[model samples]
Target chain A: MQLSTRNQLKGTIKEIKKGPVSTEVIIDVSAPAEVVASITTGSADSMGLKVGEDVTALVKASSVMIMK
Target chain B: MQLSTRNQLKGTIKEIKKGPVSTEVIIDVSAPAEVVASITTGSADSMGLKVGEDVTALVKASSVMIMK
Candidate 1:
């Protein structure tokens, strides 16, 4: 499927921290750097996410904030 | 305010495309690379954002998606 969000960073799943309703997935986007994404646990299960899997972190432009 | 979100990139505003309800903000984070952010025009005005202003783009962890 195609997404309209322009910010797409390719990475590998480095860790999955599970909670009751929320899950935090850490992605190794660059060496020594990581992107932490918090998604619904149900969504995580539905995606069948696992560590060492290749994935992309998608961020919508609308959801971003400009801090001055 | 202290934000739990971990992703924050500093950049300078390159352009602001205004729309009736929404506005698109382009930031030059790195040389020749830009990050596009869309926000409500009301919020944009309240923040008093302008072109060439130094700002930081804030992305919440929950708003991020893990795509495989």
Candidate 2:
């Protein structure tokens, strides 16, 4: 499926921190650089995410903020 | 102030599309890489944002998504 979100970074699953309702996935997009994404536990379970898996990190433009 | 958001990309304001309630801010973070942000018009007006101004695009970990 196609996404309208502009920022899509290629990464691999570095770590997964599972919570009761949410899960935090730490991705290694670039060396020494990690991006963290918090998704619902349901989504995580549905995706069957595992460590060392290749994935894409997506952030909607509306969810982004500009710091001046 | 310090932010907990993990992704902070530096860029210049490339374009601004203003609407009644929300405004879209396009940032050129790197060559050929642009990140878009939608912020409230009130915040936009308060910030006095304009094109060519340097800014940072921030996305909270919760706002990010993982796609496999």
- TM-scores for candidates 1 onward, in order: 0.43, 0.46
Candidate 2 lDDT tens digits, A17-57? 44454333444333222445556666666676565555555
lDDT of each: 0.48, 0.50
Q: Kindly list the per-residue Cα lDDT of model 1 for residues B1-68, writing each as its tens digit.
A: 44434434433344434445433343433322233466665666566555545555556655665544
> Which candidate leads the pack in TM-score?
2
Cα deviation at A35, candidate 2, in Å, is 2.3
In candidate 1, stretches whose alpha carbon ends up further than 4 angstroms from where it belongs are A1-33, B1-34
Give the interface RMSD of each candidate.
18.2, 18.1
- Give the distance in Å from residue A15's predicted Cα in candidate 2 to where it truly belongs: 35
The recovered share of true contacts, given per candidate in order, is: 0.27, 0.28
Residues B1-68, model 2: lDDT tens digits? 53444434433344434445433344433422334555666666666665555554556656766555
The numbered model that scores best in lDDT is 2
Sliding window of 10 residues with minimal summed lDDT for model 2 chain A: A24-33
